[model samples]
Target: MESYDFIVVGGGSAGCVVASRLTEDPDVSVCLLEAGGTDSSPLIHTPVGAVAMMPTKINNWGFETVPQPGLNGRNGYQPRGKTLGGSSSINAMMYARGHRYDYDLWESLGNKGWSYNECLPYFKKAENNEVHHNQFHGQGGPLNVADLRSPSDLLERYLQACESIGVPRNHDVNGAEQVGAMPTQVTQLNGERCSAAKAYLTPSLTRPNLTVITRATTHKVLFEDKKAVGVEYGLKGQRFQIKCTKEVILSAGAFGSPQLLMLSGIGAKENLDVHGIPQIHDLPGVGENLQDHIDLVHSYRSSSKRDTFGVSMQMVVEMSKAVPQWITRRSGKMSSNFAEGIGFLCSESDVQVPDLEFVFVVAVVDDHARKIHASHGFSSHVTLLRPKSIGTVKLNSADPYDAPRIDPAFFSHPEDMEIMIKGWKKQRQMLESNAFDDVRGETFYPVDETDDKAIEQDIRNRADTQYHPVGTCKMGTPDDKFAVVDSDLKVYGMSGLRVVDASIMPTLVGGNTNAPTIMIAEKVVDSIKQQYALLKQTKTASCEPS
Candidate 1:
């Protein structure tokens, strides 16, 4: 068996960061295991390539949710990144840090060190903002953040429509306030997607201390007397074991982390019994507390195809010319992240912070773009920033290769539906503004634009995920029964193991999760380093003058 100081399972966003940061100390050796292949594909580097990958399975673990009663018994798509950067490599590169209130809420819920103030340094440390030089942003960081190389005029019109209806223009949503409309700040450099792999792992690839094994799927976390010591994985149809002397970090995202826990017999006793696996530690909260953003899209066909993307002949010819432009200069249509403009709003006047968000797409994205439209169009995604409904990620079977059963019981809570209904009506008002009068055509899925029941039914029929899934292995105080990990990201009742990904978020943030997930990795690395430092000092003192 190959041995290393640390082994990080899952080469996604968090795993890449952990591996890169740990190997900075030359003596530390880390082996990163990724189920998917590399992120060197041009499809992953191009911002617009998300359109092709979101609905398909290229470098994506295209998992589907169990039939959601909340969605009238319809199964939802759950696409996660399978490669080095994880979902960050496949997602629309919107660089949102979420509302400051989100982290403060995490601290309020008994997680002492996760307050916005405490986490801000990590967020800044991970970012290298090309434009904003404010106190909230940082420069010379590994991850690059910049405005879109080429934004659509209709996106400006969408912002205008929001302003026309009283929304302010927030130049920097990642700055002080998040309540307004603005062009999305993306994780890009020179108009290319800067996935976590590109930002962190790519730079550290040559370091002899760090080993990244792609196409390596972790089957279980090997343990001895309830302490994690190594990992069992499969590569090229061959099983292998790698020992870890220090720690085992699980960063396989929200779904994969909980699934791996159960596979390792560290979950509920009943769950282990059902799977016919012997139990090690019974952590019932391993797969509970699943949360995700449920989004309702409102799309309309565009009268003119000048600025929109579609399958029409006009767009085909335009793309022909546009491809060469992007190839030579890395600009034009191919550079767009599609979901370009964003708006944050409150459902009611009494609400303290914005509870709803809008993502303006320059294409007709129906069914997460699975059902392609034949003509040019535009859409706006109305997403609930905070959802009240709870969900779970459970094992489908004992087999490690089988996909985990994902049930994001969306809209199970009456309050979630109530808020979505209100948001549905509000988006219509925003999109109906005169700013889009020249381009807007018929709605993609028409409802009685004013009737509450029609809008409610419409929301039920079409609402789905905005691609942010978190809180499966949530962080909380030891007293909290539902807490899976502690403030230091250590798995409760277990040693030499930690979860450093979106799965550790106690609650869903108010915006896109990619940036926040990267921030989580950044913050957890400090704790990991400090813990080892204290151990080293204790060991030294114990040996001296005793």
Candidate 2:
């Protein structure tokens, strides 16, 4: 059994950052296991390649939820990345840190050193923003954040539409406040996708101290007397065990992290009994508190396909030319991230902050874009930034290969439906603005556009995830029964084990989760280094003096 100072499971967004930063200190050797293949596909690099990968299992987990009764008995599709970069390699690459109050809420929940003020440094430390150099933005960092290289004219139109509906333009969504519309800043470098793997892992690949194993699926974390010591995993049908001399960090994302803990017999006794897995530690919150941004999309057919992407014969010819244009110059349609324009607004006038987030896409997206249409169109995604309903991730079976049962419980809360209805109503005002008069053709759903009941029924029939799922293994104070990990991200009642991913969020952030997930990894890496530094100092002093 080979050993390392640290073993990080899941080479997704957070895992990449942890492995890269830990290996920066040559003394600390680290091993990173990725369940998927390497992020070497052209589909993982080109910005527009995201659309092609969404419908296929290529580098995507493509998990489906248990039928949600809230969505009129529909099974929502959940696509996660199965590559070294993880979802970052397959996502829209929108770089958003949520709102300042989002982190402040973490501190208010007794998670010390996690307030926006404390977390800001880590966000800056991980970012290399190409534009907006201010106190909030950073330069000379690993993760590159920049404006879109090929922004669509529809983006301007979307902003104009928002303005027509009394929404102001926000120059910088990540700075000062997140209250208005703007062209989304993306995680890209030179018009290419700057996934966490590209930003963090690619540069650290040559480091001998960092051992990155792709196509390796971790079955369970091995523990000795409730202390994590190693992990049992499979690679090419061969089961193997690797020792962790110091710590076992689970960065397998929200879903994978909690599922791994349960597999390791560290969940509720009742849950383990059903699966016949012996309980090591009973933590009831292993897979509880699942939260996601439930989104309602409005798709509209367009009269012209000049700037919008479509699936017609004309676009086939356009894309044939576009493919080479992007390969050679790294510019044009291929560089567009699709969901280019963003807006933040309040569902109710009395709300303190914006609760509704609007994502404007340059093409029609049906069922997370899995359903393709031959017509030219655009879509506006209205996501409830924070939902009151909670969900769970339970074991489908004892087999590690089986996908976990995901129940987001979207709209289970009456208030969630209420807010969503209001948000959908507000979103329609923007969709019908005069700015889109020249391009807009036909509204796809909600035949009775003015009726509130029709709009509510339409939302219940079509509402789904915006792909931001979090808070399964939540971070909280020790006394909190639902807490999976403490403020420092250390698993409660367990030593040598930590969770450094979106799962650690006590509550979901208000925007895209990718950037905040990277920041969590950065912050946790700092904690890991500081802990050992203090230990080293104590050991040195004990040897030198009394």
Candidate 1: TM-score?
A: 0.98
Give a tens-digit lDDT track for model 1, residues 1-546. Answer: 899999999998899899999999898999999999999888999999998889999989999999998888899999999888999999999999899999999999999989999999999999999999989999999999999998988988999999987778999888889899999899999999999999999999999999989998899999999799999998888999999999999999999999999999988898789889888998989999999999999999997687888888899898998899999999999999999998899999899999999999999989988998788999999999999999999999988899999999999999999999888888888888999998899987878866888887888788999999999999999988889999999999999999999999999999999999999999999888888889888999999984
Tens digit per residue, CA lDDT, model 2, 425-455: 8888899899999999887774576787887
What Cα-based lDDT does every candidate model obtain?
0.92, 0.92
What value of lDDT does candidate 2 attain over all alpha carbons?
Answer: 0.92
Give me the runs in candidate 1 sitting further than 4 Å from their true place: 541-546
TM-score of each: 0.98, 0.99
Note the residue pairs that clash in candidate 2.
Answer: none
Evaluated at residue 184, the lDDT of candidate 2 is 93
lDDT for predicted candidate 1 compared with the true structure: 0.92
Clashes of each: 0, 0
Model 2 alpha-carbon drift over 4 Å, by segment:
none
